[model samples]
Target: MRILYGVQATGNGHITRARVLLPALRAAGVEVDMLFSGRQPDRLFNMEPFGDYRTCRGFTFVTDAGRVRRLGTLKQSRPLQFFRDYRCLDLNGYDLVLSDFEPVTAWAARRQQVPSLGIAHQYAFYHRIPGTGSAPLLKWSLQLFAPVDEAVGVHWHHFNAPVLPPLVAPSPYPLTEEEGKILIYLPFESMDEIRYLLRAFPEYRFRIYCNIPAPETQGHLEFEPFSREGFQQDLCSCAGVIANAGFGLCSEAIQAGKKLLVKPLQSQIEQRSNAVVLEQMGLGRVMPSLETEAVEDWLALGSGTPSPWPDVATALATWISTGRQVPIQVLTRELWRAESGNMLSLC
Candidate 1:
């Protein structure tokens, strides 16, 4: 079957999830075309696998100083371009359309009368999951942002709903027992602020990854350019992670059984809700701001038991190959069993 896969490039989490899904689809003998939206063409990384994917300025939120700036995001959005992209996309040749909360492809599929499947963490909001800041506006945005025919939601836990576990990168690095250093990846925050926070903890080593070019080393603090291989290496060795409460990294940390200290992006309802659920599940600690007290408290708390990772990508590929007409509950149950080791007590 010929499939059109759309991925949101607003954050690394969506791209990370797509990275795993792409190979799974190909292995299943499905012909796939990729479309990426949200970020600028130049900012995308590790993108050679998509096979000449299309890009556009569909939609993305602007962030500053570790916060999602509401006003700035409104100012930066280009509605005309978004509409044009949506109207211009051609879905005639593909047998199926799939989206990871990407607006352009979803909208175009809707307009063209194509059956679209949405696989994303955002879809989990439709179920009764642990969430905070569930305002009317947030609910409306979630529904309208990426409308699709079938929705498959991914989460850290089942929450007694049709939710699957997180799709994590293959376990390439050996699990180590070192617990002195922490891996930090807060892309939205300014580098200066991160340095200031880590500088206070002179005893703990911090390996920070950012978009900046120049690398710096001072005392126990180290700044390095972003490299997927290098980041995964540090992640394997570190005892814990300090990052925004984005779904991707938090899921990866949980899979690795690393201690987590998450500071959700301010003014983002989804992130706030994710933080709440993380705390409720005993998976991690959340801070309202990037305060030193929170970080110190988290560092002292130490790591939690590792949650079983799911092979959702393979399951998804099977479902897609079979034409996505299966009962959503059955598919979710299969994935849940794989994720929770058939231990219904975890749910």
Candidate 2:
């Protein structure tokens, strides 16, 4: 069957999920085409996997310092262009459209009456997941942002919901802990602030991955431009991870068995909720903002046990390929059961 896959490029998490699933889907003998939106074409990198993917000017949030700037986000949105893209997106030969919180493909699927499925962490909030109530309008906008015929939410825990486990690939690098080494990936925060905060802990080495133009080291801290291969190598060896509470990175950290300290983007409900769930599961530590005290407290603690989640990408792809005749509850139960008693349910 032919499928059109839509990915939101505003954040790396959506793309990360797609990265894990695309291979699995192809292995399942499904033909697929990828479309990405919500960020400038020049900004995307390490994207050889998608293979000549199409792009559109999609909606995105604007952030300053560490918080979402509502006015700026509004100013950045191109509703007319979005509508045109939506109307212009041709879905003639696609049997199904799979969306990772991408509005254009979802809307096009809706307008053309093509079957659509949303598969992303954001869909988890559709259920009674944690960290969802802070911004009511933001919460309400989820459905309007990307509506689909069916949605499969992905998260660390099922929370007694139909959500599946995080779709992360096994570490390509052999997992090994390097003492006194930590990986930092807070892209939303100011680089200068990160340098200042991390400089206080000269005892530990920080490998920061950001939008830097070049690689440089400042005393104990090493700054590198974003590279998936380099980042994965660091992730495999680092004793711990310090990053924004984006679902993808945190999931990778948990899979790699690294201790996690996350600073959620202020007013972003998804990250806040993700932090809450991480705390609830005793999987990681959360800080409201960038602060020395929070980092100090986290560093003093021992590493949490890795969840070592099962290969969910393969499982989901198999299910989707065979036909989604099986109930979501059945799929959820089996995947969680495969976790070897790692599942933590709130319901």
Candidate 3:
């Protein structure tokens, strides 16, 4: 089947999901044409996986110093262009549009009455999961951002819902505990603030990945430009992770058995909810801001236990390739059952 996959490129997490699933889809003999939005084409890197992909000026949230700037976000949105792009998009040949919280293709698929499937952590909010408070705007955005015929939510826990486990590819590197080393990825926050936060822990070494012109070192802190290979290597070898509560990075940290200290992006419901669930699951610790006291306490914690998530990309790829004949609940049950089995084996 020919599928037009739409990815939200505002953050690396959504793209990360596509990176995992696209390969599985190809292996399953499904043809995929990708469209990415919410970020400029020039900003994207390490995109060897999705060849000759398309980009659009889709919706995106603006942030300033780890807080969502509502006014800034509204000012940047081009509703006219958005409508034009979706209306102009030709979805005739594609059998399905798989959206990862990408609005352009989702709206196009809906307008054309084509089948669309939403697969992302945000879709997990459709169910009665944790950390969903009385936030009307959040609710509206979640529903209106990317509506689909079928929603497949992914999360760290199922929460007694039909949600699939996090869509993380297994790490290629062997897990190693390099003590006193922590990998920091807080793309939404300022580098100056992060530097200040790290100043207290003089003994510990920090490898921060961000949008820098080049690699630089200052005492125990090392700042490097975003590189997939370098980041993965550091992640696998590091003792822990200090990052914003982005689903993709946190899920990867959990899989790598790295202890997590997350600072949720202020005003973001999803990040706050993720932090709450992580605390509830005892998988990680949370700090509302970059506080040295919290970091000191978190640094004293022990190593994390990795979650036994199944190969969800392969499973979803197979399901899509075979025409999605199986019920979602059945797929959910099987994946969770497989996870349980893995947990038992580990025990």
Q: Which candidate has the highest lDDT of all?
A: 3
CA shift at 332, candidate 2, in angstroms?
A: 1.0
lDDT of 2 by residue, 1-347 (tens): 89999999998889989999999999999999999999999999999999989999989999999999999999989999999999999999998999999999999999999999999999888888877766666646888999999989989888778989889988889888888999999999998899889878999999999887899998999989989899999999998999999999999998878999999998788888889999988889999989899999989888656567788888888988988889888988888888856545333
| Pairs with steric clashes in candidate 1 | none
Local distance difference test values of all predictions, in order = 0.84, 0.90, 0.91
- Least accurate 10 contiguous residues by lDDT in model 3: 338-347
Per-residue lDDT over 85-116 for candidate 3, one digit per residue giving the tens place of the 0 to 100 score:
99999999999999999999999999999999
Candidates in order, TM-scores: namely: 0.95, 0.97, 0.97
In candidate 2, which residue ranges exceed 4 Å CA deviation?
A: 135-139, 343-347
Models, CA RMSD each: 1.7, 1.5, 1.8
lDDT for residue 25 in candidate 2, whole number 0-100: 98
- Candidate 1 residue-wise lDDT, 237-335, digit = tens: 789999999999888888777888998988877888899988887788998877898888888885665654777888889889988778878888877
What's the best-to-worst order under lDDT? 3, 2, 1
Single out the weakest 10-residue window by summed lDDT for candidate 1: 338-347
